[model samples]
Target chain A: MTAMNPKLIALDWGTSSLRGFLMGANGAVLEQRGSPHGITALPEPGTAGFEAAFEALCGEWLDRWPALPVVAGGMVGSSQGWREAPYVRSPADVSRLAAEAMEVPTRRGLSILIAPGVLSHPSGGAPDVMRGEEIQIAGALRLHPQLAERGHFLMPGTHSKWVDVRDGRITGFETYMTGELFAVLCRHSLLGRLMPAEAAAPEVAEAAFTRGVEAARHSRPGDLAHQIFAARTLGLTGEMPAAALRDFLSGLLIGQEVLSALGHSAQADTPLALIGEEGLCRRYAGVLQRFGAVPALQLGNTAPAGLFHFAIAAGRVAAAGEPAR
Target chain B: MTAMNPKLIALDWGTSSLRGFLMGANGAVLEQRGSPHGITALPEPGTAGFEAAFEALCGEWLDRWPALPVVAGGMVGSSQGWREAPYVRSPADVSRLAAEAMEVPTRRGLSILIAPGVLSHPSGGAPDVMRGEEIQIAGALRLHPQLAERGHFLMPGTHSKWVDVRDGRITGFETYMTGELFAVLCRHSLLGRLMPAEAAAPEVAEAAFTRGVEAARHSRPGDLAHQIFAARTLGLTGEMPAAALRDFLSGLLIGQEVLSALGHSAQADTPLALIGEEGLCRRYAGVLQRFGAVPALQLGNTAPAGLFHFAIAAGRVAAAGEPAR
Candidate 1:
């Protein structure tokens, strides 16, 4: 006989978009739908509007499977979200919510559960914030027990994160605004003049990139302006092409990430796992490899995969204390 | 009586714009004309096109005063200009250029002298290039013979140059892309989102500027990105307003100048003369004062004064240098 339909809704609501799945009790996606709406678009009188939007998007499938538990994640749980999910200090697990997971009562008598985002910050340390991504990380860990043993998980996106998972728990993590900076620099800075509007090719100016990376390693982020001038002069002097300059800029940012990770942890042999766009993911992996960290796994559908793991853990289909696969 | 018509055409052709003053060999302007065209806008044909466009603007004036000797300065003498004006490495002066001026035969039968710009690279140093501005510095030195003994000149603009003039020659200088970077960051970066198209009020975030300057004094220029995130987070935490973040970014760049300058020069009492926009000049003065360098002169019409000094030294004017007040 086929497994029964899952009872919980695993949702990923980010700053610019949202994704949700109606899973069977077995933790497999039964019906899925995503919308353009995001936490940023939520108006004041937050929960009421959020609940209505949430129902309008997922109510049909829910009506068919009545009384399904809904577990949401992402920016929707932020201060501007359906509810302000308080930040959880680092060294947290699946069962812990930074703050009370928000529960919104729908007009249709449906109950909605929103997962709290996590903030992993060491004392006198740089802080990391995640709403839905932490849930995804947790889910990913649950789905892959082997990955939980010891490794670096790079969840790359708008605000890419580097998470360290050890013994089935998120030991710690850091957020690097790599994607955001790249976007802003390419689309908004003088550097943008050289970058084509669309994704074209990955042409690395090894020398320039290496220089930038070295700068990042040795200097703080504020030094980018001077480095930028150096790079521009390189272009002006015909030492590098404009396109190569773009690549060099990207490499500098990635190099900074690699250095930041190294700063946080001294694990040299620890395997690396990358999750994000294939091209960017490969580039990051390349950067890691160049920095001497070999990747162990690369996941393509990080959001859905992580969400699946989350649902299984929440539904008890994957029993607590069971080692992650 | 009005000053006698000066003998030469004093040109200030920079990266973005060009200005010319026609003199009657007496070091006094008879007519003045400025064009949007600059070395940055000139075609690759070099001299041919540059001469054509330049002549179109000042040919008639030259026709009227056929014996006028034209002395040009600025980017028009750069490698990309009408003709390459070889850089006169450190500690060179008007006499140095007098021996190497490019003599261009004009259509109006006038002898045009192109002043060679200064190229200074102290021992194991970064190369700095200056063209028309050097003439102004020369003029300032001529005006103030005492300043020739020792002092610093702050010629702030698109590419602000801080020149160390000693013994009536530019010994060395450092170029800071403060203005250009500010333009790119404000007009092309996310920071632009904070302010409208118009220039913002100067003191919007005096605190961020001061803080950024302090940060720059201690940190390397390569580490700017991390500090940017600090600004962003400050905004996110509601501790810093978005508008103030603009000031902070501005501070970061200017602060880089302060720190970068320290490593180049050892003189603590070298007087600084600011020649640029009054607003930016004021800010730099304040910044320099913070670092313990007080302004000795604040020039309002630097180009004309620079041309005057350069002309007398280049043999276009036979007048002895006057003492600068």
Candidate 2:
């Protein structure tokens, strides 16, 4: 993969981890690098931390490919980041993201363009925001143009994003703290106290999770707040094994996310394009399928391509780097 | 308050605190004492711990009135408590609780009767359980007989309970982890990280809380699982003051609890009874009023009344203590 001429170095830096992708001509992966140092995990405070972490992760690539343009996406561009790439409001597209990208110059003489996050204002509801997911959406659209003009994208992660793209521009999106909620509830809530030992055997996890999704599907919109108590009562009543408590909760939370996200949206029937780690995306796919949502696209790890796409729009990457449809 | 001769010792021994009421005839409080050593706050393990904590809280009263019947309610009767007072399944009433009270004798030559919890099984949903609130309900009903035949009770706390009573029985109930959820999110989640410094001022807390409740009310069901993100976004966008974030979150969580618990229940409109801490009860009462619910009763510290009511039904306390409605 390193044989191609490297064109751009892209980074998807989030709260807890940093991943770097060295892209070649036509958006090919020439090489890749990763670090535990996310925006929240800097070795030092301020620019020095970001620069040192950035250099440590892919400084060799930059040293060898002196002229290579570097770009980053995610929370790395937040206010707490090395430099704030203020959020660009929707409706947006890769071009708008490029236009809003904030350039931070480093001591190494290489200026990195940190992609801005997208903020969506829902009528009659509070505003929503996303950082790195927008870049992934850009890459998804670039790789699958059929999805460019119109698509429903679900990126399941610590903070899941259900994005809507209209006419090749990013229209709007909603955020569900599904992954985060699951983590906190398991680690902090009373129901969580019963999960650990019971979750040891993953054998019954599948069934328990499915049951949770089914329960979520059948419940009313406001039901999940109290309905979650089943994670404990069922175990106490000897109706469910303690071992399945963890999985049952995982299912219930994810199920509730899916139920709320899809049930209230008119565009749910549209084919969904999922972008995230395989396991989480699979869970969402199965749950979405439960709601009769047609499986559309599964585009994973589109960060490099997305950064390349954004850089191209920003006129940083040459058009020749764009892969043909 | 201690001038009257004490006739009974009633204790509300819960997870984190223990309150003992020295009662005279007619359920009058001769004196009262409290301790932080709840069923969960034992200095040691096993019966010894409960015995020690129990004695430490009200040993003088027990010694002064050795023949006075001792009665306790709350988690003290759970499997983790002094003894396992098996749950009396719904439809259950104070009589059932009295009938199911588990008695454990102490080395002090005195016997203590621990009140039982209630288990509610909702159709097509998971089972729900409450160890202490049932006693509170019994007390509430004893204090307001008008509600015994049919009433809706909201006991807001770490685990909020929306209980349904009919024909003098606890027919059903739902538990919402509102207080716990607020705690965990504020202490653990990303949104929580932005709360402390900004929440210094209490002046705007009321408005922020009201806004959160309004948002919860306007949101579709299932939306809360994600709608909670506004606690952060609204702050970030400068739409809401940072100080307001904490209360907003509190309001959102409590409001969501109300929305889900009451939205799906047919008995929600019934004149509602609010039981629990005074402040939390006030919050529930205010939110209930917003939903057009008729506020029926605000019975605080009903445990003494509840324990006495249960003791009477159990034939431990004399009928002379029964307060006439």
lDDT of each: 0.66, 0.84
Q: Cα RMSDs of all predictions?
A: 6.1, 2.6
Compared with the true structure, the alpha-carbon lDDT of candidate 1 equals 0.66
- Which ten residues in a row are the worst by lDDT in model 1 chain A? A316-325
Highest-TM-score candidate: 2
Cα lDDT tens digits for candidate 1, B1-325: 2655545667777777788887553355677898877877764356676777678667776666666556778777777777667767768887887667787765556666777887664443224566777887877776677788897888766667778988888888766667676676566554465454444355657877887777666553334444444455445555566667777767767877766665556887777788777888888887777777778888765676566666666667666444212
Error of 1 at B68 (Å): 2.9
Query: lDDT of model 1 at residue B292?
Result: 70
Give TM per candidate: 0.73, 0.96
Highest-scoring model, lDDT: 2
Worst 10 residues of 2 chain A by lDDT: A194-203
TM-score of chain A of each: 0.84, 0.94
Q: Write the per-residue lDDT of candidate 2 for residues A203-228, one digit (tens) a residue.
A: 67788888888887777655767867
